[model samples]
Target chain A: MPSPAGTPDADPVRASAGAPAADRAGGPAGEPLIEVRDLTRVYRRPRTSLTRPGEAVHALKGVSLTVHRGERFGIVGESGSGKSTLLRLLCALDRPTSGSVTFAGREVAGLPERSLRFLRRSLQIVFQDPMSSLDPRMRVRDLVAEPLVALGEPVGDRVAELLDAVGLPASAAERYPHQFSGGQRQRIAIARALAPRPEVLVADEPVSALDVSVRGQILNLLADLADELGLTLVFVSHDLAVVRHLCETVAVVHDGLIVETGPVDDVWEAPGHPYTRALLAAVPTLEGML
Target chain B: MLTVDGLGVRAGDLELVREVSFGIGPGERVGLIGESGSGKSLTALALMGLLPDGVTASGTARLGGRDLVGVPERRLKDLRGRTVSMVFQEPMTALNPLMRVGAQVAEVMTLHGVAAGRARERAAELLGRVRLPDPERIARSYPHQLSGGQRQRVMLAIALANEPDLLICDEPTTALDVTVQKQMLELIAEVAPALLFITHDLAVVASLCERVLVMYGGRVVESGPLREVFKHPRHRYTEGLLAASRLPPRGTRLATIPGSVPAAGRFPGGCVFRDRCAHATETCETAPELTAPELTAPDLTGPEPRGDGHAFACWHPRR
Candidate 1:
């Protein structure tokens, strides 16, 4: 197996020494590609006639992490664990209440919309539901070309290549999104995400909506694409098996906080936190039974 | 006890579930495993006589002495909650948002002629049995007030409120996280007498059921002891499904079944799985009935026959 160059251990402190000198804000080896420090997001419920005072809900609390270039990082958590909130913050889709998210050596949190063009080109997201994400009325060709068209980049034959890369035929470009199955639609969504040739790809529960038989194919495709493109992939899911299969490092989130972070194998073999242990125990496996 | 034999469900000329057969003994846990569009849910709806209008069912489905197929609506309505209860995938959708959890549980008993006052008390007890904390508070709360895990427990509590002979849970834990799912599975196992657990997850089926029936293209492709089928899957589709479930070692290509499940009514005339089967030959053109092929012990050169049981509908089965 060809591991990424300069893969770090769970301990970021130890990784400081070998980290490449910061050449461009987010530099090469040694320096992290993405750094999040003390990130927190709190949502306040609106006061209603029945209730005088509104309550504050902490969606995320003091979360800190670093994603090295070309590394597959995974965030695993159940509903209400703030995994989704964290992803939104990382992608700059939503700003945090406090703390900082530095991407490519530039702060992303609270960044102005006009200045976000660079971040937009660098980071791309593939949502959970392909059916909802892809425009039903749009042709596959136009859907794949939308990112490039928005960025003012040329869309000559790029859509065709992307479809081929994701294993979809070139002819699929002419068809509407509704004509394809769930897995095929996801492939189209993936192809669209890759059209911009982004450096970082963030996928939230990409395969959870797919059938078991086709889930493997999509996972393999994502892993292969990330490696082939040397893209820094940040994948968020509740399924530990999928994370273990595709990720080198994993962070387990619980109750709006990261409970544990470590190498995928290490965490799976001996989880450090109580929540991690409980989550692992819940996964049904055929190891002994089969 | 439930015995479903040669049960087929169809709409006009289209067959949704064809020649399906299975038996769930008293207190037994049987699983129906299949991927999307495999007719697993349709078969469950057929068992409950819940197939939508315009669709008709054939063959015999005997639940104790009652016939579920083509039964009168009035009789089926009485037997539904009192005899066989079902827990669905989405708890929130399955429950009434306007109704309190406690009242919903109590309603099942009250409809069966239990005293109104006694039904409320029993509902609380059932909630407690399903491990929902603060049964009294939960009973008063609406479905939206509780968490996903709590709502699922309430669904289980309602399903078991009548102490039905059989319980059919269709992907009950699929919507839940791993930890909550484990708890729900344990509770379901503890409370239900006989369970017909339906899911696309093979590992979950292996964990909960001793016997399993593998469905594909609206047909029961394989049926037998869970361990026996898992160890040596005879049908090509079952083998593909099992192989797909397990992730290969890191950085390796996963073994995937090439094509997706055929759309409804578009299944090939002969072998429904022939399109995806690597070993399919001309012989597969003729439809094959469920049969148990002889297995030879590996140690001996001569064929050592195995006992009869486990069956697969395939022309070329792996022995």
Candidate 2:
């Protein structure tokens, strides 16, 4: 998959797909594009009487991270490990009870409602459930073009071009989602997320729902998109193999805590924490670890 | 021993499951592996006689030397949780939203004739046994109050309430994160019940189960020991699943199966995997009879071929 609205320098980035990814865009140790500090979200348990609930559920336990610009970073964890909470908080769909977020040196945590919309454009999100995320009634092209319409941007005629960037034919614009397969729908979702030309793309379990037969292709597509677009990718998945195959740097979470953070190769080779080691050991392999 | 002989499930004109059969020795842990709609879960449901209305099943299922296929509804109901219990895929949906977690668990024992107040104590003990923190505090909470992992522990507590001889786990750890999933597997291994652990995740099956039953298109494609089957899967479908999985033996790019499991009911009379099988030939036009191809391997068998406990139904065995 190629990046949309390509500039003259796109060919070089695309050519580097066969080369080492870490050196593709030079070193990533510059100023961080996304900085999260002590972010936490809590939910109260349901109760019948006026009696207050006990200690609140700690969906997020002080998660803080610095994501460098153009770095393909990954957050790996199992269910209820605060990965989803961190994603939601970053997307601004849910408010953090405590903590701050600085996006491009701008404090996103305190961004007003009107400014949040503008911020949303620079930070795009692709959710786990593509079936539910895309409207069944709407055709592919219309769904891809929704962001453009929402922002009242003048990309009216560029919709077809966006669809092709995600490896879909221009003709797919007219067909409804029911006509396409699971992997096809995810391709459309990726196209929609790319329609705005966002700098950072956060895909939450993007390939988790697809069949195993088609998962590798989707992973390759996402990786290709990240490389070509020079996009800072934050891939959230419980799958260690997929994360290992994609991301350069990784963060491991357990029970709402950031257990460990390191290079993907280092952690995979010799996990520092016992939880990470167990997590590594837990990955079902025909042989062993990646 | 549980023996399923020529079990088939038909709904309307569609055959959801076709002539599925397997045997689980006492204290056996058999992992059933397959992709979605391949009839793995449906097979489990059919075993429990929990198929939807209009679905008809044929053949006989004998559980511990007793017939389960034609057993009356009353007898099956009595046997379901008492003699044979199951842990479903989703813990949240399996639990009742309106009831307290403890009461829901206790309800299982109570239904099987445990006293009213006694069940709660039993429930708390099971919860503690599963390593839940602060069992008393958690017992008072509702299903919605607990986390996904905690709720899963509750489901296990409920299923094991009676200490049934046979415990059927249908993708029990699919909803759990990796660490919790390992812990859950360790718990199941410790219990060492006659387990039928159904899952698509091959790694969990490989590490946890001693034997495996690989399913495809609502049929048992391959059955054998875990490590042995992994190294040499006789059927092409089994090879495809193993290849598709990224875990295990790195350097192997997941061999895409090219197509999904065919829809049930109207499958071709030819070999079930013929459409996707690379070795498909005219002989596959007729469904191959279940054979002992795996039994003939020099390294596969010990002293005698028939005694090693593995069987595969395929015309063309992998080299």
Whose lDDT is greatest here?
A: 1
TM-score of each: 0.92, 0.84
lDDT for A286 in candidate 1 is 88
Per-residue CA lDDT of candidate 2, range A1-290, in tens? 01111111212232212222232233467568888888878877676567766557878767777788988788997765678888887777778889888789888885667888766788888888789999999988789999888878877767898787877889999999877777778889999998888999999999888767667667767877887888999999988777887887787766666766767777788876666776777666757511
lDDT of 1 by residue, A113-145 (tens): 889999999999999999999999999999999
Q: Write the per-residue lDDT of candidate 2 for residues B1-319, one digit (tens) a residue.
A: 7778889888887878888877777787988888887888877887787888888778887787677776778888888887778899899899999999999889999999999899989999999988878899989999887877788889888888998888889988887766567778888877747989999888788878888888877888888877778887878888877777753322234457765555565456768888888898999998887676355346654442322456677789887
**Residues B1-319 of candidate 1: C-alpha lDDT, one tens digit per residue:** 5888888989999998899887888888999999989999999999898999999899988898899988898999988988998999999999999999999999999998999999999999999999887899999999999888888899989989888999999999998887778777887887889999999999899889977899998899988778888889999999999999998767888889987877899888889999889999999988888774333334323221112247799998876
Q: lDDT of each model, Cα atoms only?
A: 0.85, 0.78
Off by over 4 Å in 1: A1-30, A48-53, B292-308
Question: Clash pairs of candidate 2?
Answer: A78-B177, A284-B203, A285-B247, A285-B248, A286-B247, A286-B248, A287-B248, A287-B249, B14-B265, B15-B265
Clashing pairs in 1: A19-A30, A20-A29, A20-A30
